[model samples]
Target: MSRRHVPAVLALVAGALVAVPAQAAHAATVQVPCSVPDLVKAINTANGTPRADTIRLARGCTYKLRAPDPVNPGNGLPVITSEITIDGRGATIERDGQGGEVPRFRIIYVDKTGVLKLIRTTIRGGYATDCPAFPDAVGASCGGGISNNGKMRITHSKFTGNTSASPVFAQGGGIDSPGSAKSTISDTEVSGNHVVYTGQEPESGAAGGGISNDGPLTITDSKLSGNTATVTPDTRSTAFGAGIISFFGTTIKNTVISGNRAFAEKGTARAAVSNGIPADSGRLTVIGGAVRDNVSDAPGGVAQGGGIANNALMTVKGVKISGNRAVAKDGIARGGGVRVGPSGTLDLKESRITGNTVEAPGGTAQGAGIDNPDGGVLRAERNEILRNTATAENGTAQGGGLYHAAGLPASGTSTLKRNTITDNRAADGGGIFRASGGLTLNGDVVRENRPNNCAPTGTVPGCTG
Candidate 1:
């Protein structure tokens, strides 16, 4: 999580970009050799200069990417304020393999307002084989990938097999961009990246298996799959965002967020796995994308917004949220597929919330595929929400397909129309549960669903009556 605010420092760097002082403005493309020895020399040369320079790497193999010592203070002071472009030449950069130390340094670390673009290269994290005790609690210390605070663009690149240890308390495991920094990633494949945090269970913790975005980010035409966000019980909050954690004003269009799993029981809860958009913040729009096959474990289980945790004013149109599961029994759990928070109203139209489940075993609690409060209205039109089941074994339960509860700081409401709700089962309100307030269903079908405890004892609609 790159949430540090340093606008003044970045301003100074941006100011220098205007007038490059003649002698330094020339297009000086310095070709650094393909080895560490030659690359260091090029960096030293760029540091000594007082202007913008371009260090173009050859089209071969580079053992590692070297950088100025961050702790030495003024060790690479000259290059810190200068603008440089380090471009790879269709090469593969691998991390160094030594003792406990990770092999390669981060691909790029932006301290100035410089622009860095990585094209046609495969940068891999170092192989330490040793999985750290906790990967999610401290993600900043592990830098096998890249960290950017300045404006950057990554095109036609692939990031795989990257790992982050517990570096700083709650940091982004891969590609952390905090504080007013704008980053755009296009045509990229980020797979097999992992954030491993040791859970109290010794094998759990929520790591942002693929990428963590603490700042405003825009991702288009990308695929994030097979990423694991896990948490062990010993930790406080292990999981926040599994595949991607979009902070304020995050937009993901024409992308696929699938096969991302956030496992608990090793921990307590998981928030915003596939699309971790803020609840009561800015806008998080998902246009033309699919969120599927994301799962959460027991105990802490998974809560709300399985495909996305939107606590803010969310409008999801032309999207599909399917095959998501949330299971827990100890305490209370809601929202198997999606969960809306207080001061949040989710307007979903032309979408599908099917094949989702919420089960509680030997416990007293309620679970729903889409959990909405009376104060928080979930308006669904032209949507198909069916084949969803909520089971509360050995205890009283409510709402299997949809559950509407009111108790937020603000008043909640749910207005559903022209949507099909069927084949769902629960102890109470199997098709739809309207606990209180307003539940307006116009032209919607509630058939073939079971409310095991319907009509109670003396009621005419009791069970089979």
Candidate 2:
């Protein structure tokens, strides 16, 4: 009962405290049921904590949102404001009203302060009708399945059957991330999404039927297919980027973007994969990807760039662009495979552009394979442009393989080396069409075109018959 006893007791107490361990900041895992309310509750609980939390959904179960919030209509769940991960375990979180009367709302909304990671999830059946009402400020309507204003990572996920139906303006039918938001999508599938606007006169239209990113976005091992961006009834509105629209540039690797359609009933329809549509400051890089079988059709207006439309600095390497169609009713149709717009530069290497077609009923069709028009610069190396068709039923068809039209002086230049341009079909300049551009073709083969090979009807420099 002396000082020795006190020391022994203190040691015992310290040992007991160390053995019990202080409350560690362990990540909490909340298992959720198949109810949307329960999932919301779990997310709210996770938001209260500081550490990263995971909400795991019941395997194979579907959590459907029946109605929008009465106070904040068109919002399905509580806004995510903290770092949280939703592990769907191959389950689905969808909007309930498929055929019944249901309010339009996105499935998930990530606020500016949120960091969301979705894994093995399926987000579907969302309809975003109005956007200014929401906090993301992407447009009038955007992000049908998920609207993200913060950082997000989606892995092994699927976004399907979502629609952005803003009558005036819309973007990102499946997922929309605007402003400074950053997102990475890997091993994902974004399919069957649509962006549609059916308003009249000066009402503008939609873009990115699968995904729209105004911020930095990177996608790897992903597939974007069967998406549509349409503007109907109103001929003044336009449509673009049925698979994806990246305004702030996007990096894609080992991806496939196919079977997408951008159609305008009266206005302009452009691009299955639209890069840098909003501005020219962005850059697009595609490595080992395939963009094929897409359609850009303006049955009553103009259509351009059926496969890829680049309006910024674009670099494409080891890519395949084939079987895309750009069809117009009475206006010009151009660039069935790839189009570089004004002030844009396209650096293509080891790529193939084959079997693309541009058709116009009464207007001109140009550059069925690659179109670099109006101050666009193209640098090609070791590429193949083969068997493309530019058909104008009652008008002129030019440059079935490559169309290089430098609109302004010293604005457009095409530098081609070690490229194959062959067997293209057009009324004139079946292989290469050069109109007022600085064309330098070094070690290139231009031959066997249906008509002549080069424009001006002669053996151009660095090209053969």
TM-scores for the candidates: 0.75, 0.91
lDDT accuracy of residue 219 in candidate 2: 96
Once model 1 is optimally superposed onto the true structure by TM-score, how far is the C-alpha of residue 294 displaced, in angstroms?
0.9
Query: Model 1, range 82-136, lDDT digits (tens) per residue?
Result: 4566666676665544364543344445443544556766666632222111222
Positional deviation of 430 in candidate 2, in angstroms? Answer: 1.1
lDDT of 2 by residue, 1-465 (tens): 111111011100000001111223787898998877889789879877777789999999999888875544666877777788899999998888868877788888776667889999999999986552233433368789887766789999999999988745778899887635557999999999998875564537677899977667799999999999998654556788899877666799999999999988668888898765334336778899899999999876778799988777789999999999999877889899999887578899999999999998888898999988777889999999999999998887989998888776657888899999999989988998887768888999989997889996553686655
Model 1 has an lDDT value of 0.56
Instruction: Score residue 357 of candidate 2 by CA lDDT.
Output: 95
- Model 2 Cα RMSD, 1 decimal: 13.5
Error of 2 at 39 (Å): 0.9
Highest TM-score among the candidates is held by which one?
Answer: 2
